[model samples]
Target chain A: MTCPEELDPVRLLTPRAREVLAAARVVLERDGWDTLTMRSLADELGIAAPSLYKHFASKDALRTQLIALALKEFGEGVRPVSGVAALVRAYRDVAAAHPQLYRLATSGSLDRDALPPGLEDWSGSPFLEATGDPHRAQALWAAAHGMVILELDGRFPTGSAPEATWDELVTHFG
Target chain B: MTCPEELDPVRLLTPRAREVLAAARVVLERDGWDTLTMRSLADELGIAAPSLYKHFASKDALRTQLIALALKEFGEGVRPVSGVAALVRAYRDVAAAHPQLYRLATSGSLDRDALPPGLEDWSGSPFLEATGDPHRAQALWAAAHGMVILELDGRFPTGSAPEATWDELVTHFG
Candidate 1:
C-alpha cells in the first residue's frame, strides 16, 4: 500500500466529510437538488451549518463531491464488458434507479471543470472505445440518454417497451 | 374568428394574465426555474403578490400555464411536413432557443393529467405519426432528447459537432 502521506487529498477526506456527503445524498434523494441546501444538510446531520463548510467549501462544492460519489457508485455497478449494449444497460439502470441524481449529475449546475479527477474522463473515453469510433459512440450515447429522459419524464407512449427500442438502437448503430 | 365566449377559458385569459406569463418567462429564462416564485414574479411586474394571484392560483398553476404556452409556441414552429427529420429539427431549435423553458415543458412538475387541453396530445401524437411506428418514434424522440440535453449541458467533447451527431441519428434511425 502507498504511504498515507502519498494518498490523494480527496481520497483522504475526514470521516466527518464522509458523513456530510452521506447526509447530502439522503437529502438529494428525498427532496431533489433544489432542496438540498447546506443548511438543510446540516440540519439533517444534526450539526451547525458552518460545520458543513469544514467538509465542503460551499453548497456547490458539496454538490460536486456528491456527483463524483454517485458516478463512482454508478461505475461500480456497470457490468465488466466492452460491448456497447452492456454499457447502455448499465447507464440506463443507474439513471432509472436514481432519476433525480442522474439529472443532477448530467444536467445540474455543477462546474464540469471542477469535477473530481477521472470522472469526466470516465464519462468521455469509455464510450469512445466501446463503439470503436468516436462519432458512433457519441450518437449511441445521446440516443440512450434520450430514452432515459423520456422514461423519467413519463413521456414514453403507453404499451411501448423501451427495452425493444434499446435493442433496435444497438442493432442499428452498435 | 370565433366568438370570445366560444373560446376556451384559458384562451380567454385577461391581458394581465398574458403579461404575468411574459414576465414569468423572462424570469425563468434569466434566473432559471429555481429562482422563479410568486413574489419574484410580482416584483418583476411591479404588482402586489395578491394581485398576481388573480391570474394564477399557485406556483404550480403558473408553471402549468407556462409549459402550455411553450408547447403551443413549439407546435407553431414545427414544419408543415411530417418527416422525422423536420420534427426533430423543430424540437431541437426550440430546445436550443430556450433551454430552460424546454426543460420545464418536458420534465418539470406540471401534472400531465392537468395539462391544458391538447397539450399532452400535441406532444404525444405528432412524433408517433412522423416515425410511422410508436416504438420507433418513442426511441427516436428519446435520442433527440438525449442529444439536446448533451448539447445544453456541454457534455459533447471539444471539436465535436452536435448537428452532425443529430444528422447521424436521423439517418440511422429515421
Candidate 2:
C-alpha cells in the first residue's frame, strides 16, 4: 500500500461535509457525546448511514475533526494576551463557556505531526512564548488546566475563587 | 421538608449497596458510560429496576459513588510518597491504567466539602504537605494534572518524554 499524501481525505471535504459537522454539533450540544453516534448524525443530516461514510470515514474520525474544530474555535475565542494573568483568564473563560466541548477537545488525540495548512499554531503558543521557556509554558498551561478541571469537577473547596487562584498561579510560575 | 443528617444516602450504604456499586462498575467497564443506566445495572445485578432505588436515589448518585470508589482505589494504588516526583508518577499511572474511569472520576463532582470520612488523605496529600502551602499545593496539583491530561489527550509534541517533563514541573514548583 502506498502512503497517499496526495489522497488525504480531509482535503476532499465538500459542502456536505460542513453540513454533516453542523448536524453533529447540534446532536453533541443537545444529546451529548454518548448519543452522538454515526447513525444519530446521519439521521440529523437526513441522510442514509452509508452516505456519511462518503464524507467521513467513521464516528471516531468525525469526533477527532469535531475536537479539532473546537480547538480552532478556542484559539479564536480568546483575544491574544501578552500577560500571563490575562492569558490564564482567557483560557478559563473558553473552558467555562463550553465545558462539554472543552472536555471533548481535551480528551482526544490532536494531529500534531501533520496538521492541515493554516492549522498548526496551538491556542497556547502566544501565551507560551510570553513565558519565555517552552517548559515553563507547559507547567503554566497544566496549572491552569488543573484548576479549571477541578473547578468543573467541583473538586475545588467551596469559596475557592478560581480567578484569584489563577492570578496566584501566574505569580507562582513567574 | 427537613434535611435529615441521619438520612444521608451514601452514609446509609449496606453490603447490598456495595454489591450494587460493584455491579455498576461491571456495566460501566463493559458498556461504557452511556449504557451504564439504572436498567442496565439492574440487569447486571439480576434485580428489578426499582430495587436499585433503595440503595441509590438516582443514576447521578450511582455515578458519584462510582467516582468516589475510583478515587479511593486511586489513593490505594499508589505507594505513599512525600516527594513531588513520586506523587506525580503515581497519579499518571492511575490515569494510564484506567483512562475512561479517570475521565469519569475527574468529570464528576467530588465531595470536597467534607470528603467521605477518611478521604481527606488523597494519594498526593503528602506531596502537597511537602509544599507547605495550600495555594502552592493547588498549583502543583494543577501542574501535574495538566501534564498528565495533555499527555493523555496526545497534545504533547511527538517524541516528547512526559516523564522528564513531569520532573521539570516538580523542580519548577519546588
Per residue, candidate 2 scores C-alpha lDDT tens digits across A109-164 of 56553444444345557556668767777767777777877776666665344555
DockQ of every candidate structure: 0.56, 0.45
Q: DockQ score of candidate 1?
A: 0.56
Q: Please provide, for model 2 over B4-48, each residue's C-alpha lDDT reduced to its tens digit, 9 standing for 90 to 100.
A: 233233455798998898888877877777667788789888889
Candidate number achieving the greatest lDDT relative to the actual structure:
1
Which stretches in model 1 have alpha-carbon errors above 4 Å?
Answer: A1-12, A37-40, A157-161, B1-9, B159-161
Classify candidate 1 by CAPRI docking class: medium
Candidate 1 structure quality by residue, lDDT tens digits, A10-84: 475688898888888888999899877778888999988988888888888877877776666565555355788
lDDT (Cα) of model 2 = 0.68
In candidate 1, which residue pairs get closer than 3 Å at backbone N, Cα or C atoms, i.e. clash?
A146-B142
